[model samples]
Target: MIDGERDLIREMARLTHSPLGHAELVYPWGQGVLSGVSGPRKWQREVLEAIGEHLTGSATRHRPCRIARASGHGIGKSALIAMVVKWALDTCVDTRIILTANTESQLLTKTGPEIAKWANLSITSDWFTATATALSSTRKGHERSWRADLVTWSTSNTEAFAGLHNMGKRIVLVFDEASGINAKVWEVALGALTDADTEIIFLAFGNPTQSTGTFRGLFGKQRDLWNTAQIDSRTVEGTNKAYLGELVATYGLDSDLVRVRVLGQFPSASSMQFIERAVVSAARTREPAPALGTDPVIFGVDCARFGDDHSTLAIRCGRDARSRPWKRWHHMDSMTLAGDIAVEAGRWKPDAIFVDAGNIGAAVIDRLRQLLPDILVSEVWFGSTRVREANWNAGGSGGTRIRVANKRAEMWTNMRHWLESGCIPDHQGLEDDLTGPEYGFDAEQAVMLEKKDHMKARGLASPDDGDALACTFAEPVQPRAVPGWLDPERYGRQRGGSEEGGLYRDLGNG
Candidate 1:
């Protein structure tokens, strides 16, 4: 290496614990990397300074430094992220860095390129090599050990985060666009913080688009553990002022869209989210009501129509939905799913079973009816016109009733109301499914729930589990009368099924 480069590296080693100092010194301000761009913006400078303060002294060295930044659009968050990554990798030796985003496309098209752009323009660019997925040391032996890897998080495959350990060294984990990241991934990533005597820094940056999730918790109940900041686009320099003004004019300043996309604030609930997070959270943690005993046990089966979707079976006994565990199958044939449903029906002897009659759902319903000849298995079409009574008001004070665009909307409306006092299983997937879809009104002002295709287009998973649960509310079912053979007091205990004798035969006309 040249003498100037060598001296620069030595200076960077001195600023190892000073991210702010390192950022200012390593990149040329008026040239290449930051060409025509003054320097780090005010908000960016503050974040870097905070990181430096947290790491500079030995007293706070061992403690993990967590910073959660929720910002409005066009605040140069990606640029700041790039600066941090470069500073961390160049200054700290053998620093293990992992960068992730809400989606793979974000990593590929945005975060990954941002990092490479800054790395190429840095003074020590020759020291590291940037690939499509990683930035590694140019030195042969340090290639694997000293590097930063861009990873895509998955709920099912969290092994990448679970194994994040760099003992006696520095470990930096950054989550870009973190609001969309699943709670399970965040939980798995927490295991990395246990490394003793290591310099740990966890950074989460994103638009506050979600009302509930690990990202939201970083500012809510978990705020004490993190240094959180919310940046409004209007307050930040270089933001599009006219565009922001237009947004405020189009959708009132207090609207959810403006709150999330412009004000860097969490919405009361997601604009399109039919069921609010607070309501779902309450239901998940609620205790079963004593009056639930009289409520009918209903089963909802939603058959998967596509390869990526899941076939789910949800069971609810009145307001108590926690007693029975949900069953989900991926890529399973209709016959197999029907057989499974039949088995659950034989086990629970539900008062009624509502199955989605879309696509291959009809075949599942057919097989289920044949399997449980005596049971009441009903087919429900999601696109069919509303058959139930309209309970919601269509704005204004006229008391005009609101009509649901289809049967799916009607069922979801019922489920949303039921959630206020219902008890449900505490599961993240179920929570995501319930809160995934957005709602809108049609030309006639009829309530229209976002279709599965639209939800997927917005990067949300298909609400299969949610739909199954909603199916349980398709129509009201009368509570089964206590049989003379069975004691009324032991009804709750015997609800699952009878092994000694056939309960299906005994429960007549269910």
Candidate 2:
């Protein structure tokens, strides 16, 4: 690399390490003085130089440039974006740069004033109309307001950026704190890039999140079009020792932010999860061939009827020096009720099979029994028993741990534990179902609003999926489940008949 290129990278890293000022912003093309571009702090300087480098780069002269920055909170994100806007307006005439955030109030309240504070219009006017909020330039008719040539909104809302005409001019569309926007809004914001004559420069900044969908994919894709950088919390450790202390102290040494923004990595996404997503995600890779007797030797059966439910069977080895615990699942809701699950279950010769005794489980269980009576197919039935579930108080300040009674609560909990640990180590179907964020523990509690609903409810939404998954891996607790008002044999017959259980049995419906 040339010394100039090396200097730019060094200066960029240096600026990133400390504060920035307008005067400190030196372009290789020409270093000139600007109005209020000087930032008085470390992060400020970093941001200014970053924006300056782009403003002066070839990307600005013709093609658009995209920069994705993942920054820590209070890292002067809003301040830098404003200065970047000023740098753009002064150098690039008729530049229609847009400033956007998660909200509009932020635009007017935060980004707007930052520009107004630094934008020093040429005082060509020899006289000023004090009564009217207008200043006449000495060059007369050349009077310009001390205002920003920028627009901002709280949302990556499409409408806010709509009606934009690039007109062969480069467009600087800045998406600040993009993680706050929804998927649809993000799509709309990105669509603004497709304008003709508009060399769409997509600039986005946000804290890292593992669950971020498309942004993650773009940055992850092996390409040269995008430049990405991460400003970690540790960058401010020496300066903001207090905040750093609290983070390290309050969150312990294993801080999520350390793994996230500091490392420029996506942290584990799931809540209530025992193991990390990174560990689970890595397990998806193909491992080398296992020595003899290393491949899986057991299958788990968590079966369900067709239509509106999931019928899953997972296989795990007794010992896996050769393979990771893998799970495979099939959604019965996507199909119809049939004896196909039973046939498939018999072929595996699993060490043990756990089946839930609700609805079609009984018939499937019975059929599997008919096929391989000797195979240890453990039948899990439910009775009203106490189960542990976390209950939160009204204020949302904190929560309480308590036990509530539920039919298959224990089974669900254990299944989650096993899946989380990658112990169900062979079936991809179970792995996928368990990995999905949609399972809920249906305890027999009749208290407050549902606590463990889906993400909205802070609970998994695919409990049915979890059911098929857990049942496939569950160790049976009860001999049988017999809801009141039904004969044992009749109950089994009725459950076997319907995909969704019988009219008489009011088991865990959801």
Candidate 3:
């Protein structure tokens, strides 16, 4: 190595012994390029102090040190993360660092770019090369050993986190926007903390948007293990006080929205409302899918055995889904309900029908088969083992696979994804039912939906409409051509010798 680079490394070693030393040496304060730049805030300094102390004391210990921060908007969480990353890279040689966020866009647009910008401004910028997903030492022997990786967490490829092992060296794991991260990712990440005689630092930072998750557990069940801090923007220096006051006034101090966006507080209770009201409302008012008539129409049926529950049928044409107006049946015999379903199937000629096969649903299915044997109907059991086969990608030639806890969880997650992107009609019953069920995890940390009894205890009716809609995601179905009534121009212009003409002729004969 060159004399200047060696001297720089020696200087960094001395400076990293304390957080303030590292900050003072690396930051370009009152100098060329970035003149008059200030260091971390008081709260951020506290976090750095804890990290420095932990590294000094745990030079020989096996246990990992964890620091997690929950903060409101614009408190500079990303900046603090950038500082810690530079400190680790400059101070320690052959350190392995993994940085991940909830999504790829967040990492690409914000977290990863900020780190690169700060790293470029450092005195030892020549020592490392910054790429899109990683930063690595450019020196000969140290090229592979010293690097920091940036990634977005996904259910697949979690094994990328399992390969990090730096014995007797430093290991740093940073998670940004951690609230939405799955529990499985957190579980697998624990394996990376097992190297003995290594300095380990795990930092998780995000807004407290989710009330239940590993992030929330940092302030709840797992509080004893983490050195945690909550930073409200209003209290921090240089924050917009007027905007904060307006937010508090607009949302009120007690609203969940205010607590998350202003106060840096976890929601007061578990999120009983699975889908947000605003998101649902916006989707309800959005335009219907253009392919509504040109794609397959699938039917989702939820059967009711007793009580005040209603057996309902939900129809989804491509991304456009709505429950039939007269699909709800109360205290109807299985034969009668099956006959009604057969009539609808004959009239609509849906591509595929998914029926809940739990409890009395099997009897209803048996009755339906006796009435219409040729109808394409599939039985779904919510509590059965999830159907985890490869799904055919219509756009591509291969099949893609996904993992889920069970049928119910898989369908609900699918429904949630659809709600975020697709349109739903404005129906009062559908809105209430969609927002009712809360999510929880099972003992093995698998995703689980709240039971009907749980919803009833919370004074919400059984989510029959929601359940019927969720059933459409049970398994992949074959797509068919458009029906005549839904294809307005084709039926209106071509009046003779086509499928549209045949449909009208049959209706007139009937």
Candidate 4:
């Protein structure tokens, strides 16, 4: 390493000497190591200066200010912040660095341990001891005060935010991993920034998740608030893939925790409850084999009515190694008891009938069991009771007698895989459900949820056909044999009525 690189590492080492407080920060890095010069690089130096500049410039009244940064992952952002915190603590007297994250556990698991480790290794002074200053609230249900005692580590909350009220005096409130902060939390932090001399350094880092929310709101003019560096997975300059392999050996790659903790990127949640998208898309591509009834069939049922949501039936005739949903028949209906299912069940004559034992479904299920008594009946359940319910209370479930539906979320995931992979022949199923503003991935919980509590509130109560179609992906399937005496022709589209009746053609008589 060059003299400058060595000097930079020495500087980083020296930050451990800083005085600990409520608003001071100490983060010093060896330019070569921190920024990637020969032994490291200049990027670190530039980033540090940029931060210094932003702080000075934003301090309009020399008032402590706020800085927000939204950047992608893996550019050594966390290391940089630690170094800065170290620097601030070493130089400023009683400097308080109020560090906060989405939760105290996250701050502990993600930031605290690492900072403590670094200090342990670098500090020559006998000053730092780590313990929780805040963990529980008072018996009266007020904010906890444990943080009031600890100098180096403290619980972070709106109350701890009193640190931000020191005006004219220099203070720094650092928000670690700001992506998880919601609007409510944002306001709490805002309220605490009552100090003019308090430097508001909002350092946030996260990967892309949605087009809306906090990170999206900070995209353009405010990006400079953060250095917003993104380090891609190519070889970092000084090493080849194998050399990089050596580094990986020192770090735990198997720990998905490391990805977010060390680099600030959201890791894959590892979902396994549903069929993957490739399976759904592949199933869509499959043509009904003439051999299905002879072999056995797996059915997909979607029982949404046509007015607002669709009713769909997806019939798959095989298992995973060769599973395929050969057909998806969907439509919207103004009337609930349209007799379409009894007619189709007759034609499809599935090895089993997989129906959503949900809203308006009991009548349909009863109708099918009455007509196709010889065929096995399986009522598949999906969604909440507020939205729909399968009356499993009617009987118990055992091997294939009938099965409760798997989580609708798992089913939706499987469906997403199909749509994005381009393997599915028709995206119509996903299209109808997600195309509307009603669907959105929740920002806080990191899952999809209804955007509006009362969708279609202004209008008449309408069934969601998209839900019906989606249910097909998650619906329980089974195979059933046709009655020994039944004919495929007899299953023609007709609600059970006199064969030569007073039926309307639109009701399926035509």
Best by TM-score: 1
Query: Which segments of model 2 are wrong by more than 4 Å?
Result: 1-64, 102-112, 120-158, 161-167, 209-226, 233-252, 257-275, 282-314, 317-412, 419-471, 474-510
Model 1 misplaced stretches (Cα beyond 4 Å)? 1-3, 32-36, 57-59, 277-386, 393-510
User: With candidate 3 superimposed using the best TM-score fit, by how many Å does residue 164's alpha carbon deviate from the native?
Assistant: 1.4
Q: For model 2, state the Cα shift of residue 290 in Å.
A: 9.1
- Model 4 spans > 4 angstroms off: 1-43, 58-78, 101-110, 113-158, 177-187, 206-227, 233-510
Error of 2 at 170 (Å): 2.8
- Tens-place lDDT per residue, model 4, 48-148, is 55556655464353533344443334444455555555455434334455666655676767566555544443332123344443222222432332111
Candidate order by lDDT, decreasing, is: 1, 3, 2, 4
TM-score of each: 0.62, 0.53, 0.56, 0.39
- lDDT string, candidate 3, 292-344, tens digits: 33466677899997888989888877677743343788877777888898888
lDDT of 2 at 7: 62
Give the least accurate 10-residue stretch of model 2, judged by summed lDDT: 124-133
Which digits, one per residue and each the tens of the lDDT, describe model 1 over residues 105-170? Answer: 999899999999989888789989999999999987999989999999887788889988999999
Candidate 1: residue pairs that collide: none
The TM-score between candidate 3 and the true structure equals 0.56
- Local accuracy of candidate 2 as per-residue lDDT tens digits, 25-100: 5322122443333323565555555555654455453455677777655565665565555444433334556666
In order of listing, the candidates' clash counts read 0, 44, 1, 52
**What RMSD does model 4 have?**
14.5
